[model samples]
Target: MPYLGLIVLVVMIAALIDIVSSDDALVRGLPRWAWLLLVIVLPLVGSVVWFVAGRPVAGFSGRVGRDRPGQASAMGFPEYDHPGRFVPQDPEADAAFLKQVRERAEAQRRQGEIERRRRVERERGQ
Candidate 1:
């Protein structure tokens, strides 16, 4: 009888860990929190329910699942990929983007200098 209790405890622990580790996007049926509460409240039944309903089905790799081809790599969204490690697909487009950024910065710098000169002139006149 005591061993049966230990088995239930083990099952419940496994269920809890599975619930916690599963991605929110992959979780099916009830929300993760509700499933957690159910499992805590009714150990054996809740664990069974969780395995049957809440757990993500097989082959689910998260928001960036293997089935999704729009995403290039396993590093997550392309824009949010680690900086300095992002390899641009089109070098020509990347160069043009950099050129636009430099031009905009130069224009802003010129405007700032003109404003500074005007401010100095006003102070001198006063």
Candidate 2:
């Protein structure tokens, strides 16, 4: 069918997008550049090869349980658990920083409450 070529073209494009978007460190089988060339040169076969061989498996982080950072040392916050993330070395300084953050947040909440009450009073007067 004439539509077969269109289908192959779409599949090839999708494979290219996937290959380009995928993390370089996670790619298997061949290098990303090689896979790119293979897909461009062979279309259907290369797309199949990429899906079968090059794709990183679901939930495969490419790291062992022990190799993973913060398995036992997580700070209870996922975002700040990265290996190179800034962590205050001094415990007292860290505590002070957290206290400052809490104070700032409470002040902002009080300011918001004050503004809301003023707006409600003005609305009632009007």
> lDDT of candidate 1?
0.76
On residues 28-117, what C-alpha lDDT tens digit does candidate 1 reach at each position? Answer: 898899999999999999999999988988653323343344554424335433212444567577657766776898999999999999
The sequence of per-residue lDDT tens digits that candidate 2 reaches over residues 11-105 is: 99999999998766568889899999999999999998999999866565423222343463223334334433444567476556666776898
Q: Which candidate has the highest TM-score of all? A: 1
On the 0 to 100 scale, the lDDT of residue 58 in model 2 is 53
Superposition error at 13 for model 1 (Å):
0.2
Model 2 lowest lDDT segment of ten: 72-81
Global lDDT of each model? 0.76, 0.75
Per-model TM-score versus the true fold: 0.49, 0.49
Mind sharing the TM-score for model 1? 0.49
Off by over 4 Å in 2: 61-126
